[model samples]
Each structure stands twice: as structure tokens, then as C-alpha cells.
Target: MIRFDRVSKRYPPGLDALSDLSFEVAEREMAIVSGHSGAGKSTLLKLIAAVEKPTGGAVLVGGQNVGGLARSALPYLRRRIGMVFQDQKLLFDRSVFENVLLPLSIAGFPPRDAAQRVRAALDKVGLATREKALPIMLSGGEQQRLAIARAVVGRPNLLLADEPTAHLDRDTAADVARIFHQFHDVGVTILIATYAGELFPGARRLRLDHGKLMA
Candidate 1:
């Protein structure tokens, strides 16, 4: 769950990314954030992930104030969060399996356990057959699915996606949206920042404009 109370983020030279933003996302709930470029969508996600500190007020995830979290405790906090970015951020030189295995490796899971988790994640994203393939060899849609697999391989409780379907065609975007729904059905709290929010019908909508929440 995420809660923000009058949160404001201002960079040097007085640029405000978010101003007095307040919202709450309950456990196991799915919500979509819509905004234009420079509308603070990504900044909102970064605040929840503890990647950026707020200039005022607070950001709390799972009941702990993220801004108050110690640097030493960040890894622990992040272990409960899964993030997918628009860029996919894949390493072309690595195989799909290796890419999905990075997080588990960082968390020190045993080799055999991590291998099992990697395969399960691939299977969930319909990429089990491509585990040995390179990211460059896949289609855009497949590459995005691989990124999703990598994010969920750790079985995070909260999933945050920033423009997950930004580059795909309508059908592919729908496919990606279904994948997110599958995870949500299984109790993963999901918050997606997207310009193509029509893909997520019936979900709670949060719109931001010029760093402020819109009514």
C-alpha cells in the first residue's frame, strides 16, 4: 500500500515536480496514473520507490515512511517493490534467463532456487521458450514481456510500471495489460503510470497536471 500526504518535490532552482500531492493506494488495489510529459507521473513513482526524497510532507509504503528510511535499509524496502520502466533496460549481451536472474542474484538466493524462480517468471510472461535467447533477438512486445518477468521474478508485493506499453501496438499493449491484471488478481498491488490508460478499463484513475493532482 502507498500513501502520500501533501507531498511536494522541488529540485534546485525552484522547479516543482510535484506540489502538495496527496493520494492512497490500498493493498491489492490497482490504479492508473495519467499525465502528459513533464506532468510528474514518473516523479510520483520515484517518490514511492524512495529514489527521490520529497521536499515536504511524506511518502509511506507498507506503513513505513520512505523518506525516513535509512540508506542501509533501502535494499530491504526495495525487495518488496517491483519496477518496470519504459526503456525495458535490458542488457543485450545477456540471455533472457540471466536478465531475469539479476535481482535474485543480488538478493543472494541459492543457485537452484534462483534458477527455478527465473524459469517460473519466464513461464508467467509466456517467455519460457526464449530463456536462452538474447534480448536483441526478440520482438518489441517480447522484450517488454521479458522486462515484466524480470520485475516479478522476486515476487514483489507492489508493482510499479512507468509506461509499460509506450512503444507497442494496441494489441500488444492490451496483451501487456492482461499480464499486469494476472499479477493483480493474485494480490500484487499495481500502480501503472501510462499515457495509454484506455487499456485499463474500470481501474481507479489518477490524473496529474503541472505537478498537481486534478479533480
Candidate 2:
């Protein structure tokens, strides 16, 4: 679960990314954040993930104050959350399986268990047959699926995606949205920041405008 109380984020000398935003996302809930470019959607996601601290107010994830968390506790916090970016950030030199395996390896999971989880994650994203292939060899949609597999391999409790379908065609975007729906069905808290709301139906909508939440 996530809770933000009167949160604000100001960067550099005077740029206000978010101002007095407040919201709560319950466990096992799915929500879609929609806004124009530079509306602070990305910044809001970063606050939840602890990638950026709020300049004022408080951010709580699973009951811990993200802004007050010690540096040493960051890894533990991040382990409970999975994130996907618009760019897909896949390593061109690594095989699909390796990319998916990286998170497990970092968490020190046993090799056999990690292998099983990796394959399962790949299958979840419809990439089981392409595990041995490099990222550069896949189509845009396939690459994005691979990224999703990598993010979910650790079985994170919270899933956050920023502009997940920004580059895909309508059909492919639907495919990606279905993948997210699958995860949500199994009880993962899902929050996606997207410019296209039609891609996600039945999700609670949160809109922002010029750094302010639009009620």
C-alpha cells in the first residue's frame, strides 16, 4: 500500500514537480495515472519507489516513511517493489534469461531456484522460447515483454510502470496491458503512469495538471 500526505517535490533552484499531492493506494488495487507531459506523473511514481525524496510532506510505502528511511534500508524497500520504464532499459549484450536472472542473483537466490523463477517469469510474459535470445533480436513489443518479465521475476508486492505502452501500436499496447492485468489478478498492487487511459479499462484514474492533483 502507498500513502502520500500533502507531499511536494521541488527540484534544482525552483522547479516544482509536485505540490501538496495526497493519495492512497490500497493493497491489491490497480490504478492508472494520466496526464500530459511534464505533469509530474513520473515524479509521483519516483516518490513511491523511493527513487526521489519529496521536498516536503510525507510518503509512506507499506507503512514505512520513504523520505526518512535510512540508506541501508533502501535495498530492502526496493526488493518489495518492481518498476518498468518506457525505455525498457534492457541490456543488449545479455540474453533474456540472464537479464531476468539478474535481480534474483543480486538478491542471492540459489541458482536452481533463480533459474526456475526466471523461466516462470519469461513464460508469464510470453517469452519462454526467447530466453536465450538477446534483446536486440526481439521486436519492440517483445522487448517490452522481456522488461516486464525481468521486473516481476522477484515476485514484488508492488508494480510500478511509467509510460509502459508509449511506443507500441494499439494491438501491442493491449497485449502489454493484458500482461499487467494478469499480474493484478494474482494480487499485485499495480500503478501505471500513462498518457493513454483507453489502454487500461476499469482502473481507478488519477490525473495531474501542472504538478497538482486534479480531483
How do the residues 112-145 of candidate 2 rate in per-residue lDDT, one tens digit apiece?
Answer: 9999999999999999999999999999999999
Clashing pairs in 1: none
Show where candidate 2 strays beyond 4 Å: none
Model 1 over residues 1-96: C-alpha lDDT tens digits?
899999999999999999999999999999999999999999999999999999999999999999999999999888889999879899899999
lDDT of 2: 0.93
Where in model 1 is the C-alpha error above 4 Å?
Answer: none
- For candidate 1, the per-residue lDDT at 61 reads 98
lDDT of each: 0.95, 0.93
Model 1 vs. true fold: TM:
0.98
